[model samples]
Target: RKMSALAGRDNDYIFRQLLEYTSFTYTYILADPESKEAILIDPVIEMVNRDIKIIEDMGLNLKYAINTHVHADHVTGTGEIKKKIPSCKSMISKYSNAKADVQLSEGDKIKFGKFELEVRSTPGHTDGCLTYVWHQKNMAFTGDAILIRGCGRTDFQQGNSGRLYDSVHNQIFSLPPNFTLYPAHDYTGQTSTTVEEEKKLNPRLTKTKEEFIKIMKELNLPYPKQIDRAVPANMVCGMFELQDAKK
Candidate 1:
C-alpha cells in the first residue's frame, strides 16, 4: 500500500503507517491527527533513520517506541529513536526482563494523542509477547503470537505450545471476527489477515490443543540467524554503545 494511503485524516483522528523491513518484519507508526502525537511498534534498528525521516516529514511528535515482545530475529530501534527523539519513551512488557523506559503489564493502556491501545498479555511464544488492540479501529498488533496462517514457534525462549494455544484462543480469537490482525513477520508476501480468517483457517490454531503441541514439537524449525546477537542487544533496547566502543 502507498505510504500516504497507510494513514490519513479522519473523524476519529487516526494516522497509521505500515513499513516493511528485510526480515519480513513489519513496523507500525500510529498517530493522532489532532495532537500529532505518534507511537511506533516493532521498529527495526536498521530502519531507524528511515522511520525518523517519516516522523519528521510528517511533523509528528513521537511519544513512545513500543515493542510487541523481546524479539529474537532482529534488534529493535527503540534506543536509537529515543536518542533522536528525546521525548519518546521505550516500552516493553514487564515479563520480558528487558530494559526499557516503561515496563507495561496486562490491561495497561498506551496513549498517544487521543488514541489508547489496550494491552493484552498473550504470552507463550516467549513469555513476554503482547498484543495491542485498538477497539475503535477494530485492529490488533499481534506480533509473532498469531501470524497469517501460522503461529509463532514454541521451541525456545520459554515457549510452551499449550500456553500458546490457550493464549490465541482466549485472548486473540475472543476479539471480534472483523478485527484486522497485523503480525510482526510474514515471509510469504502476505500483508494482513482478519481474526475471522485466522480463526477458521490458521493451520496451527485450528487443531486441537494436543494436536497443536504435536505439530509444534515435530516442526523442528531452524533457529533465527541473529538470535545470539539480537537477543542480547534487544534486551538493552538495541543500544550497542558498549559494543561500538569496543571497536
Candidate 2:
C-alpha cells in the first residue's frame, strides 16, 4: 500500500515529486521560502529536471542538496544538482564514508532565515544517519531512520535491529508529543505523522525492544535489488559515473 499526505505544503516547505518508483522511492524538495533557500533530500537522479525547474521558476537559491543516507534503491542526483546551482553546497552525514562539501554531525544547526535545523545523530538504519529538527516550526525529517506509521527495515547495510530500537525510543520518541514527523518514505497509506503518533501506533515501535528484534530476525528479508550497486556508488560520494548505471 502507498501512503501519502500533503504535510509540508501547508508549512511553506514546498515539495515536488521527483520520482516514485514501484519500489516506492521518492525525492523531495524542501525549501524555506522566507530565506529563498532550498534543499533537495534523498533526490532521485531521474527527477533532476523537475527539481531544477522548481528552484528556477521560484527564483530561489538552492543552498543544499542532502541525502539522508547513501540510498540503496535509486541513483541519487546530489552531484548533478550541484552543477546547476554552483553556489549550492552538498551535505551528508560524516559517517557516509563518502566525500561531501559539508559533512555534518550532531548538534550542528543549519540556519535558514528564521529557521534553525538541529541535527540529531540517529544511527540505526545506518551508523552515520542523522535526523534534522527545525525548531522554528517544530518539525523533524527522519530520513530512513524512522517511517511515518512504521520504522525503516534494519536488514540492510549497517542495519542493526538493536540500534534501531535504541535510536527511536531514546532519541526520537523522547521528543515532545506535538513535534511533527516527516519521513522520507511513505510505504503505507499514512503520510506525515507526529512523533507521539509513531511512538504509539507504529507497529514496529509499540513493542518491547526484545520483541522487536525477534520480529526483525524472523523476517529474514531479501536484499534490495540494487544494494550491490547502490552501496558502492553511494559510498563513492554520490557520484554517477556513466559506466556504473543500469540502462
Candidate 3:
C-alpha cells in the first residue's frame, strides 16, 4: 500500500515524506515554496504514480528525480518519473556506475529554484552511497549510510565496515548537532532524527571506530531478498523488465 505524510513545512521549503511500506523506504519531496520547483529524493518505482499525483496537485515543477545511490533493496523511480515529467532529469552518483541524465560527485550542488542540495560521498553501505545536505535548511537526506538508531549492513555491495566507520564520523557526525537527518528507510515508524541525537544515542555509531567495525562484522544480517532484481533495475534507473517480479 502507499502511504504519505506532510512531515513538516516552513516558509523556507515544502517538505513531505512518502513511504513504500513493503521495503520501509521513505521517499522525500522538498521544494522551494516560492518558485514551486521541487526535487524528489530516493524515489521507489512502485510508488511513482502516487508521487506524481502529489506533485501535480501541488502545481510543482518537478526539477529532478535523484537517487542517493544505486539502491539494492528497491528499484528507483527516477526513470519512470522522468517519463512522466519529461523535463525532470534523473540523477545518481557518478561513482554508482548507474545510468542517469546527470552524474553527481562530491562537492556537486543540485539546485532547484533557490534551494540546493550539496552532495557528500558517504560510501560504506555501498561504494557509491551519497548523503545530500541542504545546509540552509539544516537537514540532510542520508541514504543507507546510517539509519535512525542503527546503520546499514556493510556486508555486501562493496561493504566495508572500516570505511563506513569513518564516513559517518567524518561526514555525517561532523554536521551541526541540530541538523535534522532524513534517512532513506525507517522500520520503526520514526520520521527523522537530529545529528545531536544520533551522535549521542546511536548504539551502532556512537562507539569508537574499532568498536563500530567489530559490531558491524558480527551483525550477520540476512541477505536482502530483492537485491538480485533490485540492483539490475536500479542500475538502469528503474527501467526494469521483470514484470513478474514483486518489489
Candidate 4:
C-alpha cells in the first residue's frame, strides 16, 4: 500500500512506506531525493519482492536495510534484500546478538545524502530495541518502545517494565513535543502520532512508573504464534532452513 510521502526538514528527502498485512508491520523507505541514496527500515521477508520492485521503480540506490529490533512476529527481509541488492548492507542493534553487516549502537548516525538519522538505544520491548530519530525533521521511528495508546508488552525477550518506562520518559518523551512518532506496528489502522500526544494521551504511559510495572506484570498476554519460528530465524538475520522437496 502507498502511504503519504513526507518531506524532510528542507524537502530534500522523502519517507515512503510499505505496510505488511499479516504482521501489521510498517517498513519505511527513507531516501535523499538529490542523490537518490536510500535506506529501508524494518522490512518483512515475505514482502521482499514488492520492496525491491518499489526501490527499482524509483531508481533509488539501496544503501542499507536496518531493523529496529529482532522481531518475534515476522522474519526480517534484511539478509534477502542484501542478496538481491549487493550494495545494500544489513544493520541491527549490537545488543541483539543477530548477524548483520553493521551492528549499531546509541548515537550512531546513519547518513543518506544530506539527511542523517541518530540512533538511540531504547530497550524495553526487547533489550536490543533502537529508536531512530531524524532530528532536523522532528520525527522518530519508535520500534515498539512507545505506541499510540499503549506500549510494547514487557513479558518476554528480556523485557523490563521499569526500563521501558525510563526509556520512554527519558529517551523519547524528552524530545520536542511536536516530533512525529511512527511506530513499528499499529493494528488499529492508526498511521501516526506525535510525541506530545503519546506523552499526554497514551494510557499506558500516563501511569506512574510503579503503576506501569504492576500493569505489565499482570498483563499475562498470550505468546505470539510465530515466536518459536521467528526468534531463531531472526537470530541469524532471518535465514531459515527449509525441508527437502523430495521428503
Candidate 5:
C-alpha cells in the first residue's frame, strides 16, 4: 500500500509488498516519491522480471537489491535484478559469507534519496540475518527472526535458540510499540504485525529465554527440501546458476 510517511512532514513514500507464492516469500519495494529512488528487499529469483517491470513502470531509479540473509528456501533475485538494472547494486550482511556488491554491518545505512534503512544484525534463523529499520516510517523488515505468531526455525544454518531469543527481544521488540513489522515469509495469510501485538500475543516469544529455547528444540520440523540447491546458488547471489536451476 502507498502512504505518506514521517508525521508532521510533507513526505510521500511508495511501498509495495509482493508475494512469491511457491516459497511464500514477501518482496518489498520502497521508493522516494520526490527523488524516485527505490530499493528492493528479499526478492526471489523467479520474480525478477515482474519486479523489474514494476520498477520501470513507476519510473524509479533502482538503487539497491538487498537480501536479509542467505536464504535456503529460494534463489535470490538480487544478482539477476542487478544484471537488468546495471545501476542497482546487490547487498547482504558481511556476516552472511555471501557474495554481493555491498556487505552491510550493524548501524549501516542504506539510503535511497531522503529515505534510509538502518541495519540491525539479528541472527537466529541464520547467523547472518538482518532486520532493516526505517526509523522515519516506524517500520522494520524482519526477515525470519520473527513471524506473525511464530519465529524462524532454529534448527539449521547455525541456528541458535538462545541467540535468536536475544536478537528478537533486544533488537526488534525494543522498537516503538506502534512500529509495524514485515517478515520474509508467512505461512498464514497475515502480511504484517505491530511490535505491541507480537510482544503481548506471540506464544513463543512471550516465554522466558530458557522456555523459548526449549520450545525451539522440540519443533521436530522436516528438513528443507530445497536447501541443497538453494544454498549454493544463493551464496554467489543466485546469478550463474539460473540456467541449471530452471532445468
Candidate 6:
C-alpha cells in the first residue's frame, strides 16, 4: 500500500534527521539533544506508532505537536500521539478554527532544543493556515497553504482568491528566495522545492492578481470526496469518535 511504503521511507529518512516524518503527509520531528526536546509539525495520524518509536528510540522527549490548521485532506495524529507522550503540547494557528493548547500568530516563536520555529500566518488555502520557518536549515514548512508547482485551492470553507493572493504574495512570497519549501502535500512527486522556484514557475504565480482570480474561478474543481470526514477528524487532531474505525 502507498501508506506502508511511505512509512518505511519516513523511518529511513530519520537516521541522522532533524525532525522529519514522511507518512501520507510528511510529519516533521525536530529534536535537540541539549534540550532533550522535540516538536512534531503537521503530522499524519496513521504514523503515530512510527513517530513514537522514533522518539523513544532516540531518548528524546516530545514538547510540542503543532498543526498549521484544520485540514481538509489528512487527519492530524497529534492528539493520539499526545496521549502516548503526555508531556507534548499541541499547537495551531488562531485562524485554524480548531481548539488548540497553544494558538499561534504570525511571528510567534517556539523554542525547543537548538531550534526556534517562527510561525507565519499564510491563509490562502484555509483561513486558519500557518507556515513554520526554521532559521537553522533555512527551510519553511507551508502546510496546505502552499505547494510545489501549485498552491492550496481557495474553493472551500472560508476560501477566497483575494485573501489567497494577499497571503501568498505579501506574507509567504516575501521570504528570502533561497529558502527551501516543504509543503504539507506533495502532489508533484518531488522531494521539495525552493521559494525562488515556486515564485518563478508556479503557473498561478506568473499571472497578475486579477488574472489568477479569473483562472481559479474558471477551473473550479470537484469537491474532495473525503473532506466532510477529514475536516472534523482533523479539527480534533485525528481521534476517531468510536465509529470512525468502521469507515
- Best prediction by lDDT: 5
Q: Report how far residue 62 has shifted in candidate 6, in Å.
A: 1.2
Clashing pairs in 2: 3-188, 3-189
- TM-score, structure 5 vs. true: 0.93
Tens-digit lDDT track for model 3 on 142-168? 999889998888998888988888889
lDDT of 2 by residue, 1-247 (tens): 1111222446555555454655466566666665667777777666778888867776667888887777787666777787677788878889777667889888887765455688888888888788888766777888888887677778877888889889888878888889988777787655588988888788887899999899878877777887776777666445666336643
User: In order, what is each prediction's RMSD in angstroms?
Assistant: 3.2, 5.5, 4.7, 4.0, 3.7, 6.4
- Residue pairs with backbone overlap in model 5: none
Write down the RMSD of candidate 6 (Cα, Å).
Answer: 6.4
Compared with the true structure, the alpha-carbon lDDT of candidate 1 equals 0.88
Candidate 5 structure quality by residue, lDDT tens digits, 32-86: 8778889999999999999999888777889999999999899999878878898
Question: How many steric overlaps are in each model, in order?
Answer: 0, 2, 0, 0, 0, 5
Model 3 alpha-carbon miss at residue 122, Å: 0.2
Please give the CA lDDT of all the candidate structures. Answer: 0.88, 0.74, 0.88, 0.88, 0.91, 0.75
- Relative to the unseen true structure, what is the Cα RMSD of model 2? 5.5
User: How close is every model to the real structure, measured as TM-score?
Assistant: 0.93, 0.87, 0.93, 0.92, 0.93, 0.85
Runs in model 5 with CA error above 4 Å?
Answer: 1-11, 241-247
Judging by lDDT, tell me the better candidate of 1 and 3.
3
- Screening candidate 3 with a backbone cut-off below 3 angstroms (N, C-alpha, C), the clashing residue pairs are none
TM-score, prediction 1: 0.93
| CA lDDT, candidate 6, residue 77 | 77
